[model samples]
Target: MPLSSEPKLISGNANRPLASAIARRMSMHRALNVELVDARVERFNDGEIFVEMFENVRGQDMFIIQPTSNPANDNLMELLIMTDALRRSSAQRITAVIPYFGYARQDRRAKARTPISAKLVANMLTEAGVERVLTMDLHAAQIQGFFDIPVDNLYASPVFALDIKHHFRGNIDDVMVVSPDVGGVARARELAKRINAPLAIVDKRREKAGEVAEMTVIGDVSGKSCIIVDDICDTAGTLCKAAETLINAGAAEVHAYITHGVLSGPAVERIENSVMKSLVITDSIEAPEPVANARNIRIVPTAPLFAQAIMSIWQGNSVSSLFDHETLSTIYDGFYSAS
Candidate 1:
């Protein structure tokens, strides 16, 4: 990697808390001194967005930490406009660090007369001057192909594995990793292999929209501590239902480790009223008040991981080098214990 001045960190309103956490993590890095860029994002009364950089970014590597979450359209537009500002200001390379990529579920045309919205978003990002994309646990793996630039799709498997280990501790041998549905089997299998636990799947049939038919456990989960693993948890209807099904199948305890916690609609209420012991999610999306007040919800910060990736990209090291389970375990040891 040729010298491009230094890494300049910036963010939009989408996820300032996560951006700040990442900045703090970068500051803690003994190798480099990183700080948030002094920038401004303003909106016109008519609902248009405007971004301005108060500080210099000429020939600098700009990393924008903005998760397209909640108000997806507004936050997404802010990112594209901010990237344009940095590009026009002569930034060497611009990377969009989108933790929760919205419209990911629309990667394909599920029905006729529909568009592949995920591909459209990818095209929009490339057109907006994004040289690279750093995101986590995309809804569909193939969405990476939609971009002309490089895309780093990080996984939460390492963090989840480390937490599962610490959670089970001495009772590790009696644990089972479960996928809430068939689609998540691979994710659950990866975590199961990490912790050397058996894999289980929850098979549920839906008779119609908004209704689930009878559910069954595919593998033996009875009398074992079961940990369900999934990438996203939105609404949490399926997740809460899966937890209850696990308990009904005679599992000793049920827990969930999900990457993106959209937690929209009545998710908080469902989780609070569900039979699961606890639900663990990464801070990929900013937590709202209702979720922040939930009793059984636990959050493990992804800032440390993102900080490490940013440092590696700046230093010309391999981004994939950070995926090792043992390495991530050591990186987040303190926060894991606290959470």
Candidate 2:
């Protein structure tokens, strides 16, 4: 692979808009020798999946843009089938560009006899003839090691940081980055460092899988505007509860910077009624209707970053620099500062 060489970009049914946005950023036309096969996914009488890829892809460098988000099983099957199709067609290489990898939360078996679904998915991909994977902000970083093939785990921090800088430019001094839980302290710390702001942590207890009970703030959030940072926001119970706690601690306002907006169940409604001033998310996953229409929710694009990475991989260049904070700052300064 070389930077000068271009790979054919193909997309599945999931998140076509984001895929089109990425293609546009790469200056690619829709029908310019690139084809997206219509995968007629259906269920049999026994409730099993059936997938079909209707395109020719011989000797091509194929990149399948399929985010295994909601309806995770269907999308996953589609991606697997597409990979098999490309392999059967004698494609040179196949990269699964999964912007938001679903089932990533199940990377570890927290309980006895529990299955590690993330690793299972990785094995499925490898078995389906996928040569590599390109994804962003996985729920667990360790999931990368699950795959035997090269996994380029991209970050959405650069995109989110830019948006944060633009939205709170003059008031940077009042900003405090807060991690919703102990597990996310590192992620919050990174964002805080990027903006040169103080970092805080919320010490809360999760009584059950989807239920969170707020306890106390681990850091000083009083009298300062707070922004909670995390990898994903599903149900938003933890985020909203943390916001309420921060507000009670005398914080001026509370906001959130979540990479993937899963927004399942009553998430959008919960955020609408919660103390969070706003919730910023990246377009890694196709946002649901309620989230898309919510007033407090904002989506930042990650197309440019993905395009750059794809270009680097195609050019056989190092993509490690793309993850560097300084490099990100320089690249996104204009975009964020102007907002």
The CA lDDT of each predicted structure is: 0.89, 0.83
Worst 10 residues of 2 by lDDT: 29-38
List, in order, the clash count of every candidate structure. Answer: 0, 3
Q: Give the poorly placed runs of model 1, Cα more than 4 Å off.
A: 336-339
Candidate 2, residue 32: CA error in Å?
Answer: 9.0
TM-score on alpha carbons, each prediction: 0.97, 0.91
Candidate 1, residues 212-239, lDDT tens digits: the string is: 8878999888899889899999999999
* Total colliding residue pairs, candidate 1: 0
lDDT of 2 by residue, 10-53 (tens): 77778888887777766752223323444455568987666565
CA error at residue 62 for candidate 1, angstroms: 0.4
**lDDT, model 2:** 0.83
Which residue pairs come into collision in candidate 1? none
